[model samples]
Target: MRTDRELTPAELDAFGAELDALRERTLADLGAADARYIRRVRAAVRLCCTAGRVLLMFGWFPPTWLLGTLLLGLGKILENMELGHNVMHGQYDWMNDPELNGQRYEWDIVGPADFWRHTHNHLHHTYTNVIGRDDDIGYGLLRLFPEQRWKPFYRRQVLWATLQALLFQYAVAVQHVKLDKYFKGRISKDEVRPLQRQMNGKIVRQWAKDYLFFPLLALLIGANALAVLTGNLVANLLRNLWTFAVIFCGHFTEKAAVFPAEVLENESRGHWYLRQLRGSSNLEGGPLFHILTGNLSHQIEHHLYPDIPARRYAEMAREVRQIAARYGQEYNTGRMSRQIATVFRRIWVYRKPQAV
Candidate 1:
């Protein structure tokens, strides 16, 4: 529980105004270049998907099978991270392209797009790292910070964390259901049924598309059904693992802070900005690495300006660091490997109950 210097009311106001000004500048600058970049990302996604599927149909060849799997995995990552996630954030909605409509755009994951908008765009963003309010805090399954109450179940959090990463999308799919409450009799079964039904429908559709339809189509076309099935499985696994790693590193790093619920009481805009900064970390990477991570490599900036097009984060990060420094705030960031290691260390260190 590292402490941040509490800003005085006037200082908080000034700090917030500066950040709001930066956001305005970035938003005003959004135009042809931003559109071109996202369009290019969409083009790359389509190319990877189409080519990967075509190659997988010839998966009898070892080289082709390997290539196809990697290509398909890349495609899923691009779609999930760069295209789908950003578009669904309404980043490109200003361009007036119906295809990029945040509310209507559906991603390729088993979790429904509508569910994500509520769980992520609304709750997580609004609550960031507030212990009770943010569904993302340990994702209601593990204790990554000492501020969360320890439970016997959290003793094996390292194991739970690993399993969650491997099946990350499914974990995301069930997040909105709040099964913990159901088990404790907080919510009734009837209330849970509709959400469960929606989740189940999404799972069935996703599984059928990847596991059945694609494989069966390959079989009918005289290709190896087994190969197609395995390729899709491996590709999805890759997307899940990568996505889990990137997201976890961004939020659960050693320096990231979780807030007490009381902090929300009459919190000013500057205090909110400060909380977002302290609770998020950034990963340092090359341009391609940033793109693949949806520029969440600049997670600090993303938290600060979640609605701003992520492609603009890299540039915004430089100014943000300077602003943070002037405000005497620490800007947390590190290499992906370093940040990932920190998250793992947090998981292990907080696995046991904290001493009084």
Candidate 2:
């Protein structure tokens, strides 16, 4: 086992090879019964997402409309947190060949693949908890840490982000695309092919139907159009807030690491995974919290093997802790309320120097 804090070139190659071997071994060891459970869960999540989308479209008017929208929004939130996050990791067996299983474009279930790729694959995975590089800490306009120094205007950025989260649909629409382009360089035509192909006409039609056609239909139904609009807006706000709060509690809390670029470069994947584990925490409330938050409480396991299904993470976490202990690394876990309070305190107290 390599004990050095930083990997030499040869060690890096060996590490890569080891990871590949481990991945194959792990996949091979996955029990047949577990595989069946994975399939069943995937199918169930797919059904929930499909039904939620359908209901959201139709649920705009009358007494039934209000109830339907509320239920559908809750379902959407559940699917996004639980199913969508795991599915994006390619945890589902059908991911590689969606067409083979008649799986529609995944964006239909979540929001967009680009959003996942940028926020998760690129920013979160690559940077982990490095203050500036990881977009998860981008609290919109506010510099959540001292290492993320910005202009004075950033003080009010949190309010701006809250307002934007509530009202700015197009802004949210283009966020991942724009960020990827700005940070990583221009998005190649080929890179967006999945999104373009998936979205094609269906997504545009749905957007038009939902925001435009649906509202007009509600007006015609003698439903107070303003009330319907307000309800939709409120529902969306609540969903976004819930998502943001959970994510923030995990990575922006007091225990979370805020590494400099130099420290980040010195870190190994194992070390980085440990840092994320120590910095982020998991709540151990009940199955409901696990279901609603996508088993994010097992964040250490998720960081180590993102491809693992979230439903199975609790079991995997036990194994991960043993591994961490053998490696002499710390693993963090805690209650939800404590994590939330820690996040607020950290964000409020964090400061950035004018220069590194």
- Among these predictions, the greatest lDDT belongs to 1
Question: lDDT per model, in order?
Answer: 0.92, 0.58
- Candidate 2 lDDT over 156-260, as tens digits, reads 665655664454333334445444554456677677666545444444664565556656766687555555555555555556666766666667665565677
lDDT of 1: 0.92
Clashes of each: 0, 3
Model 1: colliding residue pairs: none
- Each model's TM-score? 0.98, 0.71
Task: Count clashing pairs, candidate 1.
Answer: 0
lDDT of 1 by residue, 1-356 (tens): 45566779999899999999999999999999999999999999999988888899996698999899999999999999999999998989999999999999999999989899999999998899999999899998888888899999988998999999999999999998878889999999998889999999999999999999999999899999999999999999999999999999988998899899999999999989999999999999899999999988898898899888999999999999998888888889989889899899888988899721
Q: Where in model 2 is the C-alpha error above 4 Å?
A: 1-26, 29-66, 93-104, 108-111, 164-174, 178-206, 213-231, 264-267, 325-328, 351-356
TM-score of 2: 0.71
Best by TM-score: 1
